[model samples]
Target chain A: MATARAYTNIALIKYWGKQDPQQMLPYNSSLSLTLDQFYTETKVEFLPKQTNQTADSFVFAGVAQPVSPKITRMLNLIRQAAGWSNFARVETENHVPTSAGLASSASAFAALAAAGAQAAGLQLSPRELSIFARHGSGSACRSIFGGFVVWHAGHDDQSSYAEPLLATVDFPIVVIAVLVDQRPKKVLSSAGMQQSVATSPFYPAWVQTAESGIATMSQAIAAHDIARIGQLAEANAMQMHATTLSAVPPFTYFAPMTLKIWQLVQEFRTKGLSCYITLDAGPNPKLLCAKQDAAAVVKKLQAALPQLQCTICQPGPGVAYRD
Target chain B: MATARAYTNIALIKYWGKQDPQQMLPYNSSLSLTLDQFYTETKVEFLPKQTNQTADSFVFAGVAQPVSPKITRMLNLIRQAAGWSNFARVETENHVPTSAGLASSASAFAALAAAGAQAAGLQLSPRELSIFARHGSGSACRSIFGGFVVWHAGHDDQSSYAEPLLATVDFPIVVIAVLVDQRPKKVLSSAGMQQSVATSPFYPAWVQTAESGIATMSQAIAAHDIARIGQLAEANAMQMHATTLSAVPPFTYFAPMTLKIWQLVQEFRTKGLSCYITLDAGPNPKLLCAKQDAAAVVKKLQAALPQLQCTICQPGPGVAYRD
Candidate 1:
């Protein structure tokens, strides 16, 4: 048995659409910041072949759950690489706060990739692990590295892997995720992105601009320009969401409350606050702010939105094997 | 003295960015449906040379006001065309309901172009009036015609003008304007389009797709395909708004309540109601539905949102002189 843990990440320069869906290859490069607050730990144990077990089993949060196809596909790839055929029993423990409206797929898949590869007796490097995790979930590749990470939009599977832009951020920055809605997403990320790629007239321009966004974001991180970093990330997130709006039968992730929180963020910025907002494919808005200003920002946000659940997070470490 | 009245129009395929700001030439052709419910009437009287007035005077809704530069520029064009130079006294009255959150520029400018031309003793055709109105506001050109109108994105002053696509509609179609907010717009249409043209990376693709959209929209109108018309209009409006989000310093016109109404519309459609929504540069959302579905749709919308003010409009007449 092998156990590993990986923290979740929120993209600054988002990876929205895929160039190759079969291989899970992105059309544009992406950058993200790994957060210490939310993560998943997984343990994979290959059952003895002498026992009569036909398939892998999954237990999530101490509850027996059906093994998802994604998990099975990931394990199949690991078994193929190791040349070992065995049904593994996987147990995952998600550490994310309840009803946060944040997806834990990045941490879940990254931890699964690490533990499954080890349990199967494969001595894969971190880079190799990132590549393996990508097949399970595209954003999982970036979770293999901590701090600021860049997932290159390489032409093929062999070349596309995540690398650390900054392994650990030396500057004072904090991310506050504001949970806006607890309902399940109407459209899953994969399906929404597929529709965007197929129908949006602006999808090609999004891919082109996102490539350049990575370089600028990296420079901002190097310079420790918190405002510039926040600006770029906010704009990039908006641009990513814009593609969905331009899709045929246009849709949006902006719930009424989501827009309310965004307006508050902009209002606070005008009131001399150093905070910027970014959103994923969900309605929740994440604010990037300086560490010193986090408390004040949180206080004002709570005051403005009494029902809001805000979690502050700092930069976290890369995936690591526990046992 | 000459008086003329013109009704407002809401674009089905929106004209967003300007190719030439100086000439107010659009980057893409657009289509709009002229609505009868809201209109503007203006009376222009050229002062005699003996009056010794050096500048034009203005009165709006019984209050004397300053003449805007746009009004002056438009009047100069009329004077130039007629070879008659004289200061004019302009009195305008807007007929829209209070706090409708709708811009009356289309009706206002079209009436001004018609009345100003006639007061200056210029015998101008409706086509000539459309070209004259184009100098005041881009969309005003379309208000010179009734029913379905198409404003060609021509190269220059002489080429760009509004033409009637379908001057009269025999089908059963009704437009419900939902006044979601009464607050003034933060970004004016002209400034918003200018910023979009200057910074949005997706702008080029928007221009390309809008050209084809115009053709498809025209065909849809010709067929009296109400569903197709609504689908095309909703998608086109979303695409136009998408450009704003992709602009530098990303912005959106979607207020919190606007999104709520949109979600409600989507929900009602899934419940077998035939309705689609389109938004301009502000928070108000317009619903396009068959006349048979109008009462039911409005009833449900009002029940769901008690504060919503819904105005039902039909196909309107073109610019006409009053007296």
Candidate 2:
């Protein structure tokens, strides 16, 4: 029987706003790239016989600790339906630095999903697997696939799901990770989505316009059109951040030096290098350019914005079994 | 004598952030269309003997009252440097209802710019007029022309000013205002922008990507392509509000009904008719479409969404002399 499985990191080109907080239905359609190289090695065991009043634990990178209160509550809710209340231990090991905030939740949840199913010995489809991972972090929905992926915004519990593009990427795809900081400088917690949903007036617009962007983006990705993908990702990412900006009381997660690096990255594009940038709640500016220009773009961006250390990586495999 | 003069209403296609809040020199490039129907009537007569000590009154419609204390300070700031302490009794009326919350200030100051030039006996070029008007509102800079306009992001006092479109709009345009509500909303009033400037981690990304959107939208508008124009405006507006959502407090101006009308409007386009919606501040949804289909679109929209009352109008005349 197909049970638990580990997924990889997914980046949404069309994302912003969350609808049902518990279920994590996004307000817009989002495109993502599930990568290899980095992942969360996780195992989850759900005990139908454990005691009801105990707490859950998350041991990340050999450090044993109590899980986040919110996560504990979510786990409890899921288990409540099964009439099992004993504690579950979640173990996650990162291929990358745990403190760097390299979107570890995407992988962490993917692993938990795979391991939880293995422990429970319950079979699940890709859609069920995607929905289960969504309980962990919304972006995890895309981690179920490798290569290019798109998350469709369906209305109900059975409606929303993610699908992968079978088309090959002929163009060179590269991500130059400019390391501006070694530690995640505290972004809006995932709970911010729920808060934003309740407060933001711009959230509906974000939801209403998701389909067209997602549809166009998937086409651009499938065609291996670097420019279109970059353009769509940049706009979609910006839209994601913009929805947060329009949220009631308003919030932002930016580093002062982030702007300086962004300028340097775009200056290269404006100089006609065919490069574009995407960011996710961090000061580091990721440079997306052709495989031919990848090294040059990294070197040039490093020279221009020396504050951010650069690391070049290509698209790799999705979540899979380890030898 | 200070007499009535005409000015256009400009809707910017690409506007991201403000470099100087006091002067409203936006950080991004923006394009606009000068409408024919919407205009602000203003009369400016310089009282050479009036001193700065007395309060200058700003009367809306037929009511006469002293300017608000906040505006008094801004006006004083403008007057202190120019040595134009003379009070001008500027009376203004607008086609867009005062409470509708469209950027009516753009028209108010654009007309004031025309009347101010006439009253002050200064034959300023469009750039000079823009500089004077920008002191009032950033959107006012593009309201100087009859067709299309662009505000080139110039740095500092010397280079910054808005200019009319080098290329005019090729298609006849009409705007249908579906009145959702006339009451002013409780949005952050850009307290978020100032806060995000200080707090947002993505502000740099916001600035870096703005130019491309602006440049692309400019070309789209210059070509008079409705689909491109509509796409860019919707995207650009959403981008602006996104930053607001990410502010530390997180907020948005959207309501449930706003999305319903938006869906209906976009549904029209999907049905082979041309109609696109853009919204600001209030819950109202404004449709931009061709003149030939505008009336039918408005009627259809009204019938479709009775919760929203629709009014039809066209691209207004340029700033002109009135009896």
Judged by TM-score, which candidate is best?
A: 1
Tens-digit lDDT track for model 2 on A72-95?
754654465445565677766878
For residues A1-323, write the lDDT of model 1, one tens digit per residue. 99999999999999999999989999999999999889999999998888798999999999999999999999999989988788999999999877456679999999999999999999988889999999999999999999999999899998889999999955588999888888888999999999999999999999999999999999999999999999999899999999999999899988999888888889989988889999999899999998988999999999988899999989988998895
- Worst 10 contiguous positions by lDDT, candidate 1 chain B: B96-105
* DockQ top scorer: 1
Instruction: State what share of the real interface contacts each candidate retains.
Output: 0.79, 0.18
The TM-score, computed over Cα atoms with residue i paired to residue i, of candidate 1 is 0.99
lDDT of 1 at A267: 93
Give the TM-score of each candidate.
Answer: 0.99, 0.53
Where in model 1 is the C-alpha error above 4 Å?
none
Task: Provide DockQ values for all models, in the order shown.
Answer: 0.87, 0.09
Please tell me how candidate 1 rates in CAPRI terms. high
How many clashes would you count in candidate 2? 44
